[model samples]
Target: MADDRPPSGLRSLLRDDLRGESPYGAPQLAVRAALNTNENSYPVPPEVVADMLAELGETLPGLNRYPDREFTDLRSALAAYLSRGGEPIDPVQVWAGNGSNEVLLHLLQAFGGPGRRAIGFTPSYSMHAIIATTTGTAWTHGRRSTEPGRLFTLAAADVAEQLGALDPHLVFICSPNNPTGTAVGLDVIEAAYEAAPRAVVVVDEAYAEFARPGTPNALTLLAGRERLVVTRTLSKAFALAGGRLGYLAADPELVDLLRLVRMPYHLSAPSQAVARAALRHTDMMLSTVGVVKAQRDRLVAELTALGFAPVPSDANFVLFGGLADAARTWQALLDAGVLVRDVGIPHYLRVTAGTPEETTAFLDALAALGPEHHLGTEKAS
Candidate 1:
């Protein structure tokens, strides 16, 4: 549903689809257990913070000069970082932007435009549609397998059927999909690329670090596929959301073409410096991944025990159904100083896996709910 929330005077000047659509954001409320936006709840380690400050200090002297328009060193660092995925990603095969969203926007700007189409499955990232439409590329919302036993699984057959029907210019596969928290199989991605021979297929792996063991990332499929892209971010696992660094791995030729859509010196000096510094201490920056994952698993188990059905998540959040009233539960949690995401699902709400203390707070608040909140749950200690 398009949000008809924008003003009247700007309607004539704005793109028809965007005129009334609100900018995307989760609630930014202050709470005791703030698990709403899927951001890593951990602060950057003090040691990493000091090193980042040192890196920024060195860049202050060079601020007069524009950042490396090519982001040479940062690209090398990101390439090296991604190489840990076992695919040996070369710097030439990497392209970056302010964040993964900008990387998506760059992809849309380069390949998707007026008269072109971009397609992504529903219950996935909303940005895929927003960016496509805003870039003047028509957006086609795809569906997951409707068969029983499949909640949000995107099978290869689904990819084949959808691609055959739409033939879009861009195809987005968000593994460890948002809201639902389920990862897509590498087979599904392969099917998308093979089926959409004429389209650019993007796999958004912003939460790849939190995926369960044996969950294969699409980075392994990049070789020889010029149209396949795998985008990663330092925001979630790396605790670098403030650093605003996100990059993608693709064929060198594709990376070169993306450079065309980017403005001169788009990555600022300090932004590049901080990102490089954080990348250098990737281990320290990502120290909280295990803790977050534990809390995520705890959420799934406890929610199930509480009579709510929680989706198994490969990402650092849980989406639980069985809420008698999702909106009321959201408000009650807020009143109890806990915050979560409503995600537009009627009986479901998404909560980020936070610190152990935060997890306890959320569970305690939830278990306190009575029949007014849901019938499936028992309110007990």
Candidate 2:
């Protein structure tokens, strides 16, 4: 018997704003060379795996009770790890959640809500808007530089002008931004902070470890700025996406506010234990950063040689244009056993910088597509 449920039942019951919204995610497809999600192609180091198993043995016995709500040890470990580049951070100034998304959600919950507004440059991580709207914060889609030959770079002046006009309560800046992997300069970050004196300026540095040398971290700016927050994730560089730990460094006072918004025991016992062990083996876990960066640069060169307008990247992915039809190219790649992200940009797709062999597979797939994939007169030169 067919059930006669109303077609729009859930939609009617859902919040009016969320009714037509699609959940944000990439295609979790199974393919030989999967580069769609910007995940590190390398698996966790065996040594780290053994260490995490040992730590889990101790933590498993206490699963009956709640895990440390504060995640004290994990915070301390993160603080120590982040201090490597001469920026000493205290455990008190750290916060963590299941992933950076939750951490961003906490920020929106604490600082953004009804009657408040947050602004993000366009073509950034889409979650910035999704998280803000879910928290009842109005979101402003600020513009990035669309100048001729520029790919998604944001200028400090543009940020300042937007902040002055919108007067938003929260500002999100993604360094080594998603889809278009270009890292913003520290000047842009500083400009955003100065433009909105009352706003919580968040720098989502989820791909910080993959950044080339001399790229300034926003954590360096937390010294005198109470409202500046820089969020990081172990998912990409540390190969701990499965462990699901993301954290931030900020002023201690600002860190305290996130507690009010996060749920109790948000970090589970196993999750905490695994992440702590991974941090302990940080050197081993991050052994792939150099390799990934090398591959990223290789992607830029190869894509450019193939006549695609590959954006310069500081992250583990490359966003390349010059395709006649990005969706068709995406399907063609998938058919050839490679996968990449379309990112909704016409004539463009973002592909993760995978292992050398995987990168070759992706490039070869595109090369195989030949001039048929080229937009205008540009061909592999």
Candidate 3:
């Protein structure tokens, strides 16, 4: 074998701050049931698949040419989709990237750099800090309520106070936040915006479609706020995760600034075609939302009945507590061929609301462990 030592080794070639850092990703194991990663449990409807095939076939021969640098048609489709919320948005206000993660990266590249700082209310999406730091922007770990049962709660005054003190260049507000599955109210969004006069306030609504009936989307608050941005994805609700289309809506001028950072024709023609085709069948693609929401409710109810404290979730996953040993429980579930997320929170694990069959598999596996995985104080009644 060739010598595989230092100099050419990754550690030696990596940046100083990135030397010991690990990339963010959930485990991709071959399991009977995978309730981790919060993917839509349903497959794309066959009709939508047929449409995507047709679009791809028509666009394939043109692959030799570069995709539209602006992805104008995709932007218009996204704009139309958002219009259903009763807030009409112009196509110019939309920006997209390979995924919502890449859209976030573009934001950091455009608005944040070495001298600037970005702040996020934690136990939120971990990627917020990761994206900020990777872009050379200082990352500030802001606090959320940590009272016994209020781990994911964020108050407007608390967020405003943090913003005023940290005065960061970017603020991430993950409504229907990941890991915890808790959503922040518009009051918190407004408070952060008013507190940080110069910061770009990002409201990540990746799971907005799964929110309870009355839950409002941050898109409603975008009328006149030039600094406010709401990022969403087709990955979660549209069953298009593999297509990797994530987009945001902001002021036309603000969205345009992202173009400065994005590589020319960053989105492939296939991606654009596939996303547009899926958008045409939005109703069918979203037919499972009600089913998913019902399953999510079932998870909350059943887990509560089992003596686990499942956080009230507006997203498609549930973050539960009362584990005697979270790591042990996580491994036991894996051993049983059921996988959930170990989100680094003590005594807690997050599981996605999948099909009834998958949900049953996860619940059955956890129940089979009996009292071994439960805290003595959390014994089921």
Residue-level lDDT tens digits of model 3 in 157-189 = 999999999988999999999888898889999
Clash-forming residue pairs, model 2: 176-183
Please give, for residues 57-80, the per-residue lDDT of candidate 1 as tens digits. 899998888888999999999999
Best candidate (score: lDDT) = 3
RMSD values, in order shown: 3.0, 3.4, 3.5
What value does the lDDT take at residue 328 in candidate 1? Answer: 89
Q: What is each predicted model's overall lDDT from 0 to 1?
A: 0.90, 0.92, 0.93
Q: Which stretches of candidate 1 lie over 4 Å from their true place?
A: 1-8, 375-381
- Pitting candidate 1 against candidate 3, the one with the higher lDDT is 3
RMSD of 3: 3.5
List the candidate 2 regions with Cα displacement exceeding 4 Å: 1-7, 377-381
